[model samples]
Target chain A: SQQGEEDPQALSIQEGENATMNCSYKTSINNLQWYRQNSGRGLVHLILIRSNEREKHSGRLRVTLDTSKKSSSLLITASRAADTASYFCATGAQGSGNTPLVFGKGTRLSVIA
Target chain B: DAGVTQSPTHLIKTRGQQVTLRCSPKSGHDTVSWYQQALGQGPQFIFQYYEEEERQRGNFPDRFSGHQFPNYSSELNVNALLLGDSALYLCASSIRGIAKNIQYFGAGTRLSVL
Candidate 1:
């Protein structure tokens, strides 16, 4: 079963515009990580935000986690056509002894050139 | 350094047949995990292996099992498969003991159970 729910199941935006996706989970997480997957391919790790950390950034991606609200948002600044792909949020449980991460259904982003 | 690798990019099997899928973890990675993704759905965790041992398992039944070798390579086996079992089987590798270790995935094996 998936632990998280990603909002805006699908989004389409023009190039250079920002894209924002949100995720909400029900459990107390040790960390939350985002991943990207091109069609017919495996996932790629994007960024991870620890429970104690509220926000993190890498390249044009900015992720903000609000543990109090049990939600997180991923923002892609100046999105490009290459940014088109599915984004997923996975939650790692706290002290679960190497338990596997639970992922959300994912949000599909389409960037128009 | 080579990333995680999986064999048999695609497979076709009939119901009740058994199949084995293999995976080799990325260099220096010691943990291997398996996931099943049905079409139009998120991947679901199957199990995780560390130190060549099955450390944790997800909601899957006994039909799904796996083995981790000393080299941190892994294989996922399914017996008496059902048509519903058809999906993308992914292998992910990560170093153990790192807090929230980032997992690297191999292009998954697409299994089609008829």
Candidate 2:
């Protein structure tokens, strides 16, 4: 079963505009991670936020996690056409020593120039 | 360092036939995990191997089996393939001691069961 569900199944925005994607999960998690996949290929790890962390930033990406609400959000600043891809959120279960991640259906993002 | 790698980038098999997929983990990684992803869907966990043993598994059936070698390479074998089994099979590798267990992925093998 999938543990996380990404909102706005798809999103389209102009290049240079910021894009926001949200995700909600059902069970407690040790960490929440975001990954990007291009054209059905291998996934690239984007960012990871632990349960103890509320937010984190990397380059143009910003991630926020709300453990109490069981939700997380990813924001990409100054989006570029290169950022066009499917974004997924995955959760590592609490107390399950390095267990397989439970993934969401994902949100497809399109950046148009 | 070379990242995770999977072989037979694409495969076609008839129903009821058996198929095997291979994966080589990234340097220094000790754990390998497999996932199956259908069109327009997220990747579903198949199983994980560590120390050359099956450490964890998902809700897949017995037809889905795997083996890990001492060198941290792995193989995913499926028997009596069904049409619905057609999908992209992904291999991920990570170090067990890493706190976040960040997984490195490969391009994946696309299996087409006819």
Candidate 3:
């Protein structure tokens, strides 16, 4: 079973616009990471932010985690057609190993170019 | 230079039959895990294997069994398949056990049960 849920199940935006997706989990975590999936194929690792950290940035991606709220958000700056894909947030629970990341339902982003 | 790879990108099987899905871990990886994702749903954990043993499993029944070979390649077998079993079978590999590990995934095998 999946331990997290993502909102805006689906989103559509135009090129050059920014996109934001939110994910909420049910348990404590050691680290929260984001992934991207093209179609129903394999998933691509994005960024991982540990629980002790509140925010992280890499290139055009920004991820924020609020442990008090048990949630996290991923922001994509300057969306492009290549950014269209399903984004998922996964967490390695506090006591759980990072091996199998508990994933969320995912948010589908469609960037219109 | 090869990433994780799964054989038979697509498969079709009938209900009540059995099927096998294979996976080859990325070079230098020693752990393999399996997941099942139904249409429009998140992937569900199946099991994890390391050093030719079943290390951990999720809620799946005994009908779902797996094996990790000495070579670090793996195979997932399911018996008495149901339509609900038709899903994307994903295989992920890691350098060590699942705990505190980052798993790399394969393209997955799309199984369709008729």
Candidate 4:
């Protein structure tokens, strides 16, 4: 079963614009993380926000977590053509000691130059 | 330093056949986890290993099994292969302490069950 479901399935934006992707999960989580995957490539970790954190930032990425609503959002500011990729949200289920992360289908973003 | 590594970037198999995929974790990492990603879907956790022991599992059936070596490398084996098993299999490695769940993934093995 998928723990996270990304909203807007896909997004297209111009370079220099900001792209936002949302993810909603069903269970309590110890942390929520965002990752980026270029076509046919392995996923690269973007940023992680712990349950106690409301938001986090890394380079051009901003991640916000709303544990009460079981949702999170990832914003990529100054989107670039190089940022064209699929973004995924993964959750480490609360109390699930040492379990692998449960991921979402992801949002496919296309940045037009 | 080398990150996680997976072998045989691709594989083809038939129904009722068995296949094995391999992974070598990043240096100093001790845990290995496997995930299955179908086209247009997220990677689903198959199982995790630590200290050569199966520490946790997802909803996958018994046909999906794994082995972890003393060197912290691992293998994912699937028996009675079905078309539905055709997907990208990923291997992720992480440390055991404060970074327990922050995994580094290897380029997945693309499996095709014919």
Rank order (by lDDT, best first):
2, 1, 4, 3
Per-residue CA lDDT of model 1 for A1-113, tens digit only, reads: 88979998999999999999999999998999999999957999999999999999999999999999999999999999999999999989998435688999999999999
> How does each model score on TM-score?
0.98, 0.98, 0.96, 0.97
lDDT, candidates in the order shown: 0.93, 0.95, 0.91, 0.91
Model 2: lDDT of residue A69: 96
What C-alpha lDDT does candidate 4 achieve relative to the native structure?
Answer: 0.91
Off by over 4 Å in 1: none
Better of 1 and 3 by lDDT: 1
Q: Place model 2 in a CAPRI quality band.
A: medium
Model 2 TM-score relative to the real fold: 0.98
- Pick the DockQ winner: 2
- Please give the TM-score that candidate 4 achieves against the real structure: 0.97
Which 10 consecutive positions of candidate 4 chain B have the poorest summed lDDT?
A: B94-103
DockQ of 1: 0.66
Q: DockQ for model 4?
A: 0.65
Give the Å error, residue A89, model 4. Answer: 0.3
Give every prediction's interface RMSD.
Answer: 1.6, 1.2, 2.4, 1.9
Q: Is candidate 2 or candidate 4 better by lDDT?
A: 2
TM-score of the A chain in model 3: 0.96
Candidate DockQ values, in order, are 0.66, 0.73, 0.59, 0.65
Candidate 1 backbone clash number? 0
